[model samples]
Target: MTFFRAFCIERSAPATREALCGRFLSLDETALDAGDVLIRVECSSVNFKDALAATGRGKVVRRFPCVGGIDLAGTVLRSAAPRFAPGEKVIATGYELGVAHHGGYAERALLPGGWLLPLPASLSSQESMAIGTAGLTAAMAITRMEENGLKPERGPVLVTGASGGVGTLAIDMLAGRGYEVVALTAKAEQADWLRGLGASRVMLRSELPLDAFKPLDKGIWAGVIDNLGGATLAWALSTSKPTGVVASIGLAADSHLSASMMPFVLRGVSLLGIDSVYAGFSVRERAWARLAADLRPRHLASIMRIIPFEALPQVFGEFIAARATGRTVVQIARSGETEDMT
Candidate 1:
């Protein structure tokens, strides 16, 4: 019967254009949505989507007074679900979290039994939050690419927006899989850091421009994991080698793609849309398994910044401005300790 503090956004009027005023409030367990498992949230990571939801910029928040964190890693405090028990470690991301449902910004969370995944043996709760939804999206993109015949022997793989969380993880995971990875970043200062994260080469976004609406360009990449979805994705599609697959994960840029169909019709290129939120449980389990095994980033800790929960508002602003790099994890509870739910 313990109460906790949480951040909430309340919108008074529903208009096509509206503003959200967020504040910290006290909440009890009864305030959380009904669920079979109660988790004492240890860490919750900040993602670009979380930023959008927090700011009310991109229709990410469907309801008022909602908590906004898409990814949470914690210890189970109580569970009616047979798969999970008290003291078990778990992580939850995607599947309507931080959107239509109340999310993980609080010290506590009540999530559906099926939405919870047992923490992988190799990852700690902090490490899992560091990976978060951004890392999972990267893993899903890589898994999709591999399933579509991407191989280390083919040629170089390109990761667009390579300094962001998903982009950084994609670079690390692809390089870990033995692919020669080329990182494309808008920030020139992060070139050395990207290189240290196993990137074979780093290029500025200005260096790779889509000057013309050409149907196709010189074939360079064996595959591409594109987080920037505007002209950058269009250029990747036009320039990828024949039979190459391009996985579109995020839309940091504009979502609309204005390009010719000649790349697909003439070059046999494939554009794969990656939606991590609605992915099936089996698929998510396999993705997490792969992340625990082959896809875990070697220098994962280097890219993570741990912050207190109170700093989330400012962090959200930085994320929305595209200034924050790597993973921003919010520490809600002490490490290796389970809360009493009973």
Candidate 2:
């Protein structure tokens, strides 16, 4: 039996007040959850949800002792599913990964083939992981908005949580497509960086009068990609132009929405719920196709940082504290070992 390293999230012994604890463990194939495709995980990336799950900060993990990564890119070592073959380069994100299933924090992963997609040829495994769940959500938001008649010429698009992964990637993608992007962030220091990511302007979160959300404010944004929920989302809806689109991707701040329907009823504003997890195969495919093409972030190198797999345990707090920016890719396999499974 071969042994491999995995980061597992498990229940703390009954005496401990904390409900969950995460740790590194050595395990064999027998320890992994049952699935059709076996992969040698080359790379994985940290997402806000992954941080919440690993740290017991949010109700994210559904199964105890599950591996702790939501996104992975790898080469298939074996596959019983007819849709996949051994040696194929693939990527998997969302679904039950890192929540209810053994996930990508391990050197090896066993997952249903339905959860995987052939990695885009233009992207390396590290690149795919850098994009990960955040990039996928951003792409879905853009594609959905475009399909619903959003155009670059309509008006500026506002991306909340602008220093985070989804916001940074969305700014790059929107700018690449010739849209004027206004980034909303609490970090004033990141203004120049956000602008370099193609944002035309940076609006500090503190600058927005979130406490004073009006039923209908002067229409400003033609579209809004909101990562933070609660008051920021309400503000986005209240100030959107007629026929505007708002894609809600995350609830990092708060989940509750206390807003008026004046924007929807009078301005005809559309609020789209972007659910990356459990999105249908067709939706995932379409999003990835766009990601590989026009929707790919132009500032990927500037937006991503690579860390060794062993360092994963120490980094979750950065996310929990909202101190991390852009993307952090975990290098799982040793250099030059991703394709050489021997």
Candidate 3:
């Protein structure tokens, strides 16, 4: 039997107050659930949700003894599914990965073919991880807004949580498309970094006046890609131009929405729900194609930090504390090894 590295978390079997702890462990191939495609993981990236699952901060993983990485770019080692062949470069995200199933934190991954997307020609495995789930969500937000008649000439787009992965990438993508981007962040220190990613202006979260918001305010935003929910999201809806689309992708602020229909009914604003996880296969393909094309980040080197897999345990806290900048890619296996599996 062959053994591979896997980061696993387990709680007490009888259930106690003892916190769940994750550690590096060697796992057999058969230990992973049955799936159509077997992949030699070239790399994986950390997401905020991965931290929640690995650290047990949130009930992200519904099962125990699970690996915690929600996104991976790899080369297929074997395939029982007709859509893929061995040695094919691929990417997988969302779905049951890292939750109900063993995930990309391992050197190997087994997944249903339905969950796989061929890596775009424009992006290498490292670049894909640098984007990961967060980037995918950002791209989806843009695509949804564009399909609903958003144009670069409309006006400026607002992105909340501008220093985080989604916000940074969204700013880059929107700005790359010639749209003026307004980045909202609490990290004043990162204002220059946000602007460097193409934010035309940076607004501090503290300055938003969350406590004193009207149902409708100035129609400053042509569109809003909101990573912060609660007051920020409500504020986005209230202040967007009439017929504007607001893509709500994150709930880091607060999930509850305490607002009236004045924004939707009177202002004619549309709130788009962008769900990268379990998005239809067509939608996934379109988003990846866009990422490879117009939405590919020109400043990927500035947005990525590559680390070895062993560092995952310590880095989860960075995401939990919202201290993580841009994206962190985990090198699980070298490219040569990923492409040539014995």
Candidate 4:
């Protein structure tokens, strides 16, 4: 195709304070950024970062007029890179996608082959996008924590931002691995749903005085997969057991961290910052393999929703408002193209 539709995020001219503008535009194939692989995008997923960039809510977009979807799965159409060839199913995420570089939100994406991975055989395009960057981050976090001596029998693992995509997937993965998964969320209403996703206990954020963090609270958590930063992160650290591993994934709440060093110095708690973007190929491959096998979320069908590509603009608000749940996969393949990617 010479031209295709893409939801592009553009900057609104030169302003004192730059504002991002996002819209659907028909873009020429030549307009795409240079890359070795050309992919016919079948599916993409909306992430918290996508919402921030598309809506201009957060300072996420590093470059202007970029197509915005951090995670994409599709069939490759052309390749200059020796590792990939035409007609192979593949997935791409992170590494400047949706922010600095043109990303998935288009019918076709031209990206460096090094930024892509063979789509796991067990995961279809739809299912892969359903997992997307969020699931990948969760899997990476779990893998990192486990490598740091976190085990199912260590103790309970706390997942902050529990109603969101990463938190939900982490809960499912942790519980499936026989760990006691405790979900911490502001939405008390989703307690039962979180439980269904394998959260052994649901802790409401309102119950905790996040700002009133003690230097050392009763050591409760053996591991923590923290999505929200700021006070929530501080509380998690302060309450962690000796040598507990905390994987800091996202800064949805606030970026600044203010807490006593008691958790780290006194108890030897380990805080691991998960950088899914710019992660080396070997690390991602190992995580993806586990994602397809044991770390794969068991309640995916129950928590995921497939939406038509046109409906993409409508859901950004839900994410910006912190009302989004689980995962939302965008079906990007046009009509007449195979919709049953699974």
Candidate 5:
């Protein structure tokens, strides 16, 4: 049995609900809920969901006093499962973590063995967290596009919200795989960064007129990875080439889509909904393997901002406010040493 320091939220007074505070507390191994594996959490990353959960918004937490982090990477300390063993580095994301269960905010975590994947040989623990759920989702989007016949010989591919983690990685991976990548972002200042990540072209979100609800428009892109749904998705659907596909991974803008279905019926456009939470293990493994292989972006480390655990709350606020860019990783343990928090 071992004990470690962890962050805990304490709601002192009912009137001070807005002032709910987080403090470091000493936690014992026995405090962890039942699971087949015990991991020492070395690093965790902030996603939009994590930010929402940390800020007490979006109904992200179903229960109080929960450790809030949806993605974590570390080393296995102990495992009763046949597939993993002690001293192996691993990653855990999605599947009720950080929401219905205590998650990666702690220095240690206990998780069902089925929820963990062996850390890919091509990625370090830090790199894995840097990729996190965003990178994984990006890879899944590309895989879906390819599965839906998004060929390199086809015309250009468009990535909406290209300044974000998923969008940036999608651009890098798509371009890396020999497709002409068009980055769509609201941040004009990040154009150089997006170009550096292999985007062939960059367009501002303001340039796209979403209010025009035309049945169909000029067929521009061969395919699209749309992280911002709502108007962007509707616009993408309306403007996509014949037989083009759009993988809808997020609703950062809004969930509702007010558009005609003529594109779907006439142009053979397919809108695929993507969810990381319920992805099958085979699909998860394939995505991670591809991320380790061709989809691994060369500029991944450059886009990441590393901060200590103490700074998680403030950084999360910035993420929720749309002020944070690229990927933000929380360093929970000493450098280079994998912490098992299972």
Candidate 6:
């Protein structure tokens, strides 16, 4: 309404030097970045990328003085595109937002019209942020698995990084699809929580490699939805059944893979890399629709942690240190003027 509050990382000192500061600032409509549509952001989420941008840990933000949030949902306050109008609820994520562009860590956000998605009928702004890009990746992994001939009737499905956002959501989605899902995580304390998300069995990291993996060990898993790459991915590949599909999404552990081609050639294993960013509108829409329908979480509140804007810095630290799990939704605009919003 008046001055907007935003959490941003601004460039400072010598231009050649890469000094940055993260803090809160007051801004007006003029300060909002330019885009085809202006939205009053109701909620933005704390994704790993957002945490990296906010904390300046990784090379996630290419521009200086940019807001730090990768996912946002809100009511459009103004629109230049024919596809959207004032007072329409929309969601924006991926593409260049929060990276090359000023993103959604503010009370108001200006986003390219093409990046906006009408909120699925089944989800609210809060729920959309809870799902965010992580859910999209999980949904994409599932869709890709089915396309690659992964049927529930075949056997059990394995989910790596079972405590993380994508892993948790994938477990829920895979179990919801009638597949027997086994979760793999290092934290044994969260076993109950993982099971609540639909994991039939939870295995700690030591349980894996299960006595050293060869080129192809056993055909235990019909499908694998993996978030951690590197050795974890290699293990999944080596243990997967013949003609098994493994969807690789995130690389929180390590980026490089040290695996032989024996699994690929001998087992006919297929490794699909899931990219949520820059996914086409049709694919994104289908993913959200599946999210609203079958992939909808039975324990949404259980999988999400909501914090006010003031808690961003702490949460960002938790994310970077790998101390946080599940999804975290940031309440940006607490008092959105959405009474008349359609």
Q: Return whichever of 3 and 4 wins on lDDT.
A: 4
lDDT of each: 0.86, 0.91, 0.88, 0.91, 0.85, 0.85
Candidate 5 lDDT by residue in tens digits, 214-258: 779999989999988888999999999999999999999998988
Residues 24-91 of candidate 6 have per-residue lDDT tens digits of 88888787777889888888888888777766666778888787788999988888989999988899
* Candidate 3 lDDT tens digits, 1-342: 768999887753313222335789999998998799999898999988887777776677888888878999988988999999987899999998998999999988999999999998878999999998999999999999999889999999999999989999999999999999999998999999989999999999999878888889888898999988998898888899989999999998898888768889997899999999989999999989989999998788999999998877778878878888898999999445524453
Per-prediction TM-score to the true structure, in the order listed: 0.95, 0.96, 0.96, 0.95, 0.94, 0.94
Pick by TM-score: 1 or 5, better one: 1
Query: Which order, best to worst by lDDT?
Result: 2, 4, 3, 1, 5, 6
For candidate 5, give the lDDT of residue 51: 70
Give candidate 5 regions above 4 Å deviation: 9-23, 335-342
Clashing pairs in 1: none
User: How does candidate 6 score on lDDT?
Assistant: 0.85
lDDT of 3: 0.88
Mind giving the per-residue lDDT tens digits that candidate 1 earns over 230-331?
899999999899989999998898898887788899988889999999888998999999989989888888989999888777777787778999998899
Ten-residue stretch with the least lDDT total in model 3: 11-20
How does residue 101 of candidate 1 score in lDDT?
73
Where does model 2 exceed 4 Å of error? 13-20, 338-342
- Cα lDDT, model 1, residue 327: 91
Runs of candidate 1 with Cα error greater than 4 angstroms are 12-20, 334-338
lDDT of 4 by residue, 212-319 (tens): 768899999999999999999999999999999999999998999988899999999999999998899999999999999999889999879999999998888788
